[model samples]
Target: MLSLRRILTVSATLGILLFLSFFLEQRLQAVAFRVVMLSGIAVVMAVSLNLINGFTGQFSIGHAGFQAVGAYAAAALTVYGHNRIFGNLPRSGQLPDTLQGFLLGAPAMICALLAGGLFAAVVGYVVGLPSLRLKGDYLAIVTLGFGEIIRVAVENTEAVGGPRGFTGNIREGIYIPNLTSFFWVYLMVVVVVVVSRNLRFSVQGLQYLSVREDEIAAQAMGVNTTRVKVNAFVLGAFFAGVAGALYAHFEQSVSPTSFGFVRSFDFVTMVVLGGLGSITGSVLAAVVLTALPEILRSSLGAEFNQYRLVAYALLLILLMLVRPQGIFGRGELRLDRLFGRKGGGGPAGRDNVEDQPAATELR
Candidate 1:
């Protein structure tokens, strides 16, 4: 558990880091910038999904559906709003780099992102209501079906460019311009991680864990397992939606295919590959998986690129065989556990002396 002061310090430090990211983005190369932004989005998705699939032990495969909803919502709002507001003005990304641009561009984009999150949260509640009651493969089926349904619905909707997908170039403020994305992306990553961590330590979070450990036991103990499950889904989906918005804004376009069933599995892979119930592991896995393909293609050339996904699948298979609990297992990396290897026992913990009566008596 972190103390209030320590937590606040961490929050402030992250805020400072966000400020520094904007300051440093101007210096980072294009590829590096792209990686950072994409990694941030990955972190958002992986950590948020981990809350549902990892901590809550729910099998949700429709996360991409919520993301699509958010993506299209934000994109439509931005593309249309920008057109209606400024018509032919220069895009927000092209605005002055001075304080004025920061004030205007940052706030408008933040509102759009938050708006996207709000829309997703409402939809998450609706989807979670009926679906969270089920468990195991049934739940997965429901989520998968939900995702496909969203895709089909979007494809048929002529308002958002139909099957061709919604493509737009912003000529003014309404979306997050690519230029300021690193700041927004990493900031949200920090937010997701912090919220997940905090929730896991809260009373409600314990109920979530209890439900994961045993739903019947949790229910018997008076914990509302259904409530916990729905909360997990809604919270996780909100972050996923925010990730979608950031992604859509960065790419400056989105399609039904962008957030398909396969994309949902990519997130699941990140969570399962990372240690479930381990926030740090999720973040690390997100960064590695997000960057692995690019690294391979650049370093190993074109032929290897085609087999990259195969390599990823193989690596996951090997990890399951070798370390089924993932790189870190159920526990997390804590500062207290870093300095020394302490024996598992009482008060300050005792030395490991299973066969030494005298050693046990001494401590």
Candidate 2:
């Protein structure tokens, strides 16, 4: 079903990601690489959350709960199935560079990621069924409770190490192979961004936007608001789960404390700091927020790193005060817009004018 342009775009993206991953793996410092990978994960989280909070106008805040489900599910699979699936393959700190190891390991990793995502999507559906009927603060409360419940449940579950955390022990033959790499992380980033951008322009996405703009009116217009909201939740949760899988594999560990309300709030902050409905804004915010802490730590001594939160809080406060609607105010960044060409007053111009009312409402 894929078109020629779509296939070409995907092929070119993969080629670029492959080259960059190899080059960066060889040249980037360890800390820099970690930051970059974390940023990619953040990008996934922020963009996915935007689909719900921005596009769908749902204020669910328990994104970390879905992320937790994915992380543990993927980690458990990789840890328990490593020996059976990978055989005598030796565990390494990074992905296997050799062709044989890649052949043996890549499929399992892909399956694990898909399983995690699907599991999270199921959970999202369950949560969305009752909760999406509520709006604004009520929905947020339900979601916040959901996240807390996940953390508490994880704390009590012994099979996953409970409070101790899941660090796959090599001696016990349990291992979570380091399968996450720049190629995978950025690949997901690109996928999420592209899908989000396309959805924004699609008919289904218009239904989502309508619900966000006015639920009652959207329903009157024959939009199945509940279905749209649930779809958004599921899609968002799926991507968050994949991102969580990547995080678990990259960090080589999972803990109950990692996916907490604080983490969910962080994603919300990124969405708010960026424009609510702007994909590029979310990406930019994710990168900035992810890297800011590392930059602070490197510039300020380790002893002074504790104060970084104070600076982060202050920055957010200032930004909110200055531009409460966010950087782009529901509009996306475009090269043509930047250069003031206005699509040469052609079909693109007409499209822009047609879209202006919705854009104004969204803002």
Candidate 3:
């Protein structure tokens, strides 16, 4: 049974997210809206990757591969099923912002997203099989290879437009409706964060941490390291797939080039920069990194924008040199901790006690 405090916390979180979604959709400029959506997507990706790389101490880097699979899978479903399921209904972008419109569109959108996530999870399981025998750089290499293989495979698959892209042809009665919104994106954000936080404090999470600390030792202690690592990959890929589905629907298109190794590297950077095994750090890093480039473009104008990458690289180097464990290290930022008050008794207090050793070592 859930406690009253937990219920209230959940209610408050949903209420705040609901208000922000409506407010930001109505008030933000187009550029800001795009940035916000992209930031939410980044948060999802980073947090999922943190489970595998940060908590499980796995160095798999083929996240973009899973995302690509999800994008194409979800896009295919939405485009092909549009006429059959929706029956000449207006695209989500064209729908009026009324409760009726939401009711009409939500079912199809939810189905597509779930299909994408499930397909990606299956692929993740296949990819994770190699992890049973490989570790560290070897596993990273295998995952990197898988990412490239996926890209090449997609590039050759003419059904998804091959190297061109997957933009549905309206004349052919195939169209990817714009079904993504601030509400959907941030709702997933809240769910992923809450899930990650709960997992981080649970008994299973202890198995993950032990694997990260020492796989052999963890195995000796009766933990099924292989299963834990594979579970991490599957869960991480599921969330990445959902994020990709959101991206596909929001952009109403996807290309093979978009989900390449470079994209995977960017997610890796976000995880490492935020601090391994830190959910709050991942969220903060995702938002900052997603917004930073746009901030540069707007502030520096077109001419100086060419040097933005240089500035970005320098900043990362400086941060790593100064605080290699990342901005928040492995601990979360708590209001009580900030106020210099002892954490009140509960699961939250227990989590603080449990996580301290890891954080201290990093410091």
Candidate 4:
């Protein structure tokens, strides 16, 4: 049974979103709309990676492979499944209804996104199984290999347009609004942030932190370290998959080349920019990094776009030199920070502490 308060909250949020989406859809130009949507996707990816690399202390970087998995799966479902199930592509006459309905005339893009996320989670479990045995650079390299393998494998599979790309053809003339609309994208962003925050503050979340601090110690304390690690990977991949689905539907296509090493690196950069273990930081970094290039391109001209990467490298270097922990340094920018609340990694905080042997300090 749902409480009235809960019901009202959901209702109010939906109303606000409808208003927001409708208003913005009317006013914004295509480019601004695209940037906002892409920022939402970046938020999902960055937050997901933070769970694995930041909170869990793993350095795996094959994030793009998971994204690809979701993108292709969702695209295939939309493209091939439509033909098989409906026997014809969607018609524009019913497009508004189709888009608004949960039904998959093309399968509501949400369905594809969910399907993609589920598939990616399963694959994450499989990949994470072997990954649990590795550590440090070895783990990073292995994950990188996994990503490369996924790209090559997909490159060969002709069904999803293989190297050519999944065009997401809908019988030409069928108008499919980009599924990464402000409402859907922001809704996922909220869900991702809420879920990640809840997990970080929960009992299982504690186990994740313990494992990150010391695997041997965590095992000694009876925490199922393996379970925690695998759980992290699965959840991370699931979100990444959702992001991929959004990416595909937004672009109206999918290709192996999009989710390559550079894409993976871009995600890594987000995680690093936003302090590790800091959800707030990740969100901020995602928005900034994603919008920066586009802003530069529109304002300073396309030629200045080349300087984006250079700026990133320079900013990253300066950050490392001045504040290696990142903008927040394993902390978060909260309202309290503005109000002068100083926090420490005491029993209440998460920072590792040292213990001196009793009675030996004087020596």
Candidate 3: the clashing residue pairs are none
**TM values, all candidates:** 0.84, 0.91, 0.90, 0.86
lDDT of each: 0.77, 0.84, 0.82, 0.78
Q: Considering every candidate listed, which one attains the maximal lDDT?
A: 2
Question: Which residue runs of candidate 1 sit more than 4 Å off their true CA positions?
Answer: 1-15, 83-93, 96-99, 169-180, 298-305, 339-363
lDDT of 3 at 285: 91
- TM-score order of candidates, best first? 2, 3, 4, 1
For residues 1-363, what per-residue lDDT tens digits would candidate 1 score against the true structure?
999999999889767876776676678887777787888898999998999998878998878898888888877766676656434324543555554655556655675688678888898899899999999999999999989999999999987767987765423334335424566787888789889877776667777777787788777777778888999998998898898888887887789998897788878878888888778789988899888765666678999757766777898899999999888666566655687765455654222211111111110
Q: Mark the regions of model 2 whose C-alpha exceeds 4 Å error after superposition.
A: 88-103, 169-171, 299-305, 338-342, 349-363
**Model 3 per-residue lDDT tens digits across residues 291-355:** 88767667778966577556657767998899988888887887677899885456655546445
Root-mean-square deviation of every model: 6.4, 3.0, 3.6, 5.5
lDDT of 4 by residue, 39-146 (tens): 889999999999999888899789999999998887777666664544444544133423343233334666777978998999999999988678889989988998
Question: Evaluated with TM-score, which candidate comes out highest?
Answer: 2
TM-score-best of 2 and 3: 2
Candidate 2 yields a Cα-based lDDT of 0.84
User: Among all windows of ten consecutive residues in candidate 3, which has the lowest summed lDDT?
Assistant: 354-363
